[model samples]
Target: MAQYKTPGVYVVEKNAFPNSVVEVATAVPAFIGYTEFSDNKGTSLAQKAWRITSMAEFNAYYGGPPQSKFSINPLPAADPKAPPVTGDFSITDSATKQRTEYELKAEGTSYILYYSMLLFFMNGGGPCYIVSVGHYGDDLDADKISAGIDTLLKEQEPTMVLVPDAVRLSAQDCTTVQTNALMHCGFKMRNRIALLDVYDGYKDRQDPAGDCVGAFREAVGTNFLDFGTAYYPWVNTSIVKEKDIDFTVITNLDVLTDLLKKELSPITDAANPTPAAKVKIDQLNAALAAITSDWTKSQDPATDKQTLNKTLLAVSSLYPQIILAIQKKLNLLPPAAGMAGLYTMVDNTRGVWKAPANISMNGVVSPTVAISNDEQEDLNVTTQGKSINAIRSFIGEGVLVWGARTLDGNSLDWRYVSVRRTMIMIEESLKQACKAYVFEPNTANTWVTIKSMARNFLTSVWKRGGLAGASPDDAFSVFVGLGETMTADDILEGLLKVSILVAVSRPAEFIEITFQQQMQKS
Candidate 1:
């Protein structure tokens, strides 16, 4: 009420309601990894948090995916008793009437962040932040990755942290990155969660080296387990289509050319070569020569690259095999980015309380290693209480996320992912709403207003099925006052304290049915 001047009648507007709590986004993830480029026109987004809503925005600002190169090598001799590694295949030489085994090995450290970004967008991810530590060809340095994680401190919108490139580092280094991420989310930020991927997740649990899940549990340490979740094994995705690959991806062009020539020797060495065979040989030779030739001399490198691709596809039969192998290599990606997208999709469609499990993943062909129910038991519920989620493939369900527990599986308070995330959403939303009263007098009037505002906001969440109760009163409680959450000393020290308690909904991870014989009612 303002003092009236000159005895004139005055009307004062008074707000009857306290400021409402605006729910913070629960799934905008921050991705820290290498990108092709981070140039938004002239400005560089290197090691900075940049928000992008769509893949188009990402490509425009950060360029496109990496050009991963592979080398075709003869498979080394293996003990007959040992099983062959994944991705190993055999090709028969028709002229020699013998079969030869071969494997496609990555030429160098394959930069997977670009491909992982594609996977994230493919799986229904929405707005996210990208922190490019460096360009595509830079080494995967742990210090650089840790620095990138630090960049997110200034950005408050992101609720999850994912470093898809961390899996490319050695086990020790990858664990270091995961540790840093967990610490950042749980200890430093206290408002976000970290989605982690097991190193060498494609390998089976019984791999000769050791159990991948066991190694992850041992190395991930005991701090802030509730703030992170791990998924295994890696998924074989369809993000890299056949059309995206070409002969240029093969680094051993000389060896590939020799192999193609040998394949064509049956027709070339013929005493009386048919006209069709001669034409085929000539076209193949021209394509090979063009590929080997210096492309800098070409007037248009872009068109020349496309023409060379089409020529190789049309003339060489072995070229398809090489391209397929390369595609597979690129498609075997860690599961963190895809999980980040899943979180976003689930949060958007359902509330943040919904468990992101038992849902089939998009752009996923299958899990790299099949896990039977018996095998997943160990992964789902371990002795050390470090639970790792399983991406399992059912007979008709395709590839599905099978588990929903956090790393601290044994703790009933923060066991499920949904419970933890739901709490985070509530805490953050109310925290923002209370900021309006930061310097206001910490008295009974302010306390009542804050409590009413929180109750109203939580009523909405309860209606949305985020809390486990029949009524708003049963779902949550908010306390703030001299005797409740704060004492006289606390108010004297300028501390306005608030305490909240909510019974978050938990997922029905297991259901059992019982059947018994009954007397005929009729």
Candidate 2:
């Protein structure tokens, strides 16, 4: 109503009905790890969140995966013909006039972020955030990793947290970081979930019932365990190729050159042979002696250093290659990143209630630990309530996420990952929609509108097979009022409480069939 005398016609169209809840993004995970490089345009992205949509986007912002290295001291009586550590490690064997000989060798460790990124995008992960705690050269300590997860505290869009590189830390440190991640996801945010990876020792497929499982349980502890889920054992992936790894070896070049000079010095031609043969030997010896540090240097002053650097495989480039090669030896890796991708895929294709299991994983050759039914029995249902899911490869079905339990394996209510995740989705969606009611009078009108809004949103979820009931009434209930969800004193203090209950669908983990003999109708 305006002053009638001077006012002209002013029509304002407003929302006629209650505002509905906008379902929160369920699969946008924030990955915390060490990156080869993290930059957008030119600014550094260290300890900050960067959104990436595809592998191309990841490459554009953060450089491709990094190389890991392994230094191996030759064993007793080194064999000159020993196979290279990786397919490309360099070997060196040399002998002096005194018959003294020695050797050297090297290997690669592929950057978890790079190959894991490839696997994630190939499977089904979409726009997600990445926190590059440090560059490849920086120390990948638990502190750096903890800081990375901490950066996500300011971000609200990411609903899941993953730290694929955490396995690289010490077992004790790994527990600390994982504990922090769980607290961040479960206690602090309450809207997000944490995905964990078992330690690398579990990658030894021979240790299905190894002490590492118990070690993991002891380290992670029981506090806020329900907020997280861990998948084991690790997985062997085809995402990383030898070329992708770019391994560099300190080959037998120097050794071969030394050996050649040693053998040439004792040639019969050199001892008492013809003058021409002796001259030829002398010339060859001179040539061998000329192979000095400057031999690889270019003649041009401008190109000398650059050429030598390239020819020598400068410390920066070759070190990564060395590392990448070592990592390639055991191609199996932690499962958190790949599982994050699968979660995104399942959430997008089906509702969140659909357990992300029994589906073939892309780019997965096989699981590091072959968890047979018998082996998984202990892992999936342990007395300690630290259930580890199995990523098993079937005879014909390929590799699948065979289990769906959360870390709180013994809790009847928060037992399944789907149930926990579905509730988180609902809670986040309603919380966001309630923002409109902030500062508004907390009265009966507000309660009714909130209830209606929630009902409409949940009814749609029910239709989508997220709820387990036969109808909307059976599937969920909403309570928000003075006497119901809030008391008079609660309303006076501006605390408008709204309670909601929903029957989340669980995965049919086991099916039973019963048969009885019947008399034949003759």
Candidate 3:
């Protein structure tokens, strides 16, 4: 209302159209893992959520990939019949007085965040958030994972949740973390997807129907399978390189070998060395050369020391590449992070309803387990509805993501990942759009405006092939009014209710055709 005392004429503008509903993005994933560092321009971000838009940004903040992990703790039994470690060398164990046999394995903490992010962005992942629970060398147990998950609760932008290091936790602890993740995505956020990875043992198992999948199912429980998805047979990646492991951490093998030999028995102008002693000396010298080439100059001021370091002190470094190659081969990454990357790729190229399956995965060398169609039958269409998607490598197609069902495999409504994601997109969009009419008068005009807004949004989705219907009416229906969606008492109670029914499009999981001999008549 304007005051008449002003004695002036004024032209006032008013909004002519109702508020429009804008579809929310459904691809941003928040990965929880370990990186080389967690600092942003000298500011510590450990155990905190940080936004990274590009690889350079992530590198500048969190640093690059750390070295692969390896150790020789689990040694083999000593052979009494075999010749002793003679002539030049002696071995010592921390626990026992002396050690005889050593078995080197990549069993230390894996600094996978940098490489996982590399894979994610390489496979078409876009701007996303990272909840770095800790840096390399930090223990990532169930408590740390759960704490990492809690950081995402305040973030509304992330539509997908992934814990790439879930395999590192103990079985019971992993179950606790995953259960909490399901709760966050399903009951708490309701707008995000939980991409989980099976236990590491599933990657190399000879049997698919036995304890592997059974262990996973028992741990994940049955409550909110619809909110999350599990991927099977971890992916063997080439992302790790020998150069990534800082070689400098190893001691000079030749010098140590000579010192041990001299301590055993002084050789002053003694006879020629035995063949076994010569072999040991040669092995030591070669390992020392490798360390001198890579590790000795690693401390130079010009060298970038962001990469991590690993040591296999107990084993022979005669051919370090053999051990390093084994480490790379054993670097079986869980599928959650990769799936997040695929989710973003598919949602961008095709709409959310388009299943992210039968598509080749970038940055993957091969699937750890070769899954045939018969093996995938139980995985894709399981009776328990605990669908585990498979990653299989075909001859020409490369390693492709083959399945697209959600954890709720048997449900008609929320079976496929696309259907679940599509509904989330729509639901979030409509909920945000309705915020504009929160305290507006509850009248026919308001009801009509809200209904029109929702209908326009759904109609656009249908036009873009997100919904299934021959007409907009058949595609979706929006009801909001005095008699349609709410009663007189509901209005008095300050309740503005709207009932929306939509025909969500489902993926063609199975495409079959009927053929008959009569067709020859045509």
Q: Rate the local accuracy (lDDT) of all candidates.
A: 0.89, 0.76, 0.76
In model 2, the runs with Cα more than 4 Å from the true position are 1-14, 70-110, 201-210, 245-330
Worst lDDT 10-window in candidate 1: 84-93
**What residue pairs are clashing in model 3?**
248-295
Tens-digit lDDT string for candidate 2 (237-272): 877654333212334335434444544444533457
The most accurate candidate by lDDT is 1
Report the lDDT tens digits of candidate 1 across residue range 1-522: 565668776777888988888999999999999888999889999999999999999899988988888887887656669975344556667666766777888877778888888889888899999999998778889999999999999999999999998998988999999999999999999899999999899999888899888889999999999999999999999998998887778888898888888778888889999998899999889988988888747889878888888877887777787787778888999998999998989999998999999898999999999989998898888779999999999987799999999999999999998999998999889889888998999899999999999999998999999998988889999998999998889999999998988988889999999999999999
Worst 10 residues of 3 by lDDT: 306-315
- Please provide TM-scores, in order, for all candidate models, with all chains considered together: 0.95, 0.80, 0.82
After superposing candidate 3, which stretches have Cα over 4 Å from the reference? 1-12, 72-103, 201-210, 245-324, 519-522
For model 3, the local distance difference test gives 0.76
